[model samples]
Target: MENTSCCIYTFSPYIFLNAYGGLHGGAVAAVAEMVSIACARTVVSKDKDLFLGELSMSYLFAAPRNAEVIVDASVVRSGRNVTAVTVEFRLGESGGVVYTAKATFYNMPVASL
Candidate 1:
């Protein structure tokens, strides 16, 4: 997939504080998960699918609510049954990295939902 396809989300104060004065971890995780899936989709074709077996991230810096953020993901390794992906969350203007994640996707056969 084209790198330009990566999604960019603007950080807003509402998205940061929900009846609270701090950023929500779930929001961060959600962005990471979306990037992971997007990266996996770019690698596997229609005949195949990927299951997110494991995902991990380290939030190095607090994401500011005043700047634009971009999520970029790429495949690290692809195997017969597994694919490893890496995702980076960066500031759109400064190009500073705020978070990094790694995930492994599993390709398997199971009962179709």
Candidate 2:
């Protein structure tokens, strides 16, 4: 199993809206994406030119309020050109999961860019 890395980000009141307030969908997606990239950097043998191929996320529950958010990603599959990762975001204190996502990264040559 590939090693996993974790990141903790702080959330503010403005991140939420309606009754269930704390981290909008877009915000969660952003964090999940960051987690995926971090995981890819840790697992993938390629350079930094790789691009995120696809992302899938599931919002499990509402996030906590005025607390630090934690994100973690684990390597699921690794290849010479592609890397798959699973990521999750949760409340720092309670460790309650708020969102989960999967991302695939593909190495893109700099000449293609």
Candidate 3:
């Protein structure tokens, strides 16, 4: 199957900020995971379900509150049972990357649901 890609614009709220007043690492990771799963689902068959296997993220810069960040996610590898995806968080349109993440998902057959 062809690779799947998606983009979204998000705002870092103060509630998701860290002690340094930047976006919390956990929040960023959550976004990466959510996007990766969405990308995986697009490449997999309708009867298959994708679950998070492994995930890793590298925070290169801080995302300040109220700043509009762009999130781009794409599938890198789509295998029979395992799929890999990458996600990037940017400052804005055509801006530098603030965070990067790589994730692997395991596909399972969906039955009775």
- Per lDDT, the best of the predicted structures is 3
Model 3, position 74, has a per-residue lDDT of 89
Name model 2 segments beyond 4 Å from true: 1-3, 6-19, 46-48, 109-113
Report the C-alpha lDDT of model 3 over 1-113, residue by residue, as the tens digit.
44467546466444788999888999999989988888777788988878898999999999877777888888888989998998989987559899999999998987784
- RMSD, each candidate, Å? 3.8, 3.0, 2.4
lDDT, model 2, position 86? 88
TM-score per prediction, in order, is: 0.76, 0.76, 0.86
| Runs off by more than 4 Å, candidate 1 | 1-14, 18-23, 110-113
User: Model 1 Cα displacement at 45 (Å)?
Assistant: 2.8
Each candidate structure's count of clashing pairs? 0, 0, 0
Any residue pairs clashing in model 3, and if so which?
none
Residue 83 deviation, candidate 1, in Å? Answer: 0.8
In model 3, where do residues sit more than 4 Å from their true spots?
A: 1-4, 12-14, 111-113
Residue lDDT tens for model 2, 15-98: 454466656788778878887787677665554476889999998887756767777788888777778888877777888887
lDDT of 1: 0.71
What is the alpha-carbon RMSD of candidate 2 to the true structure?
3.0
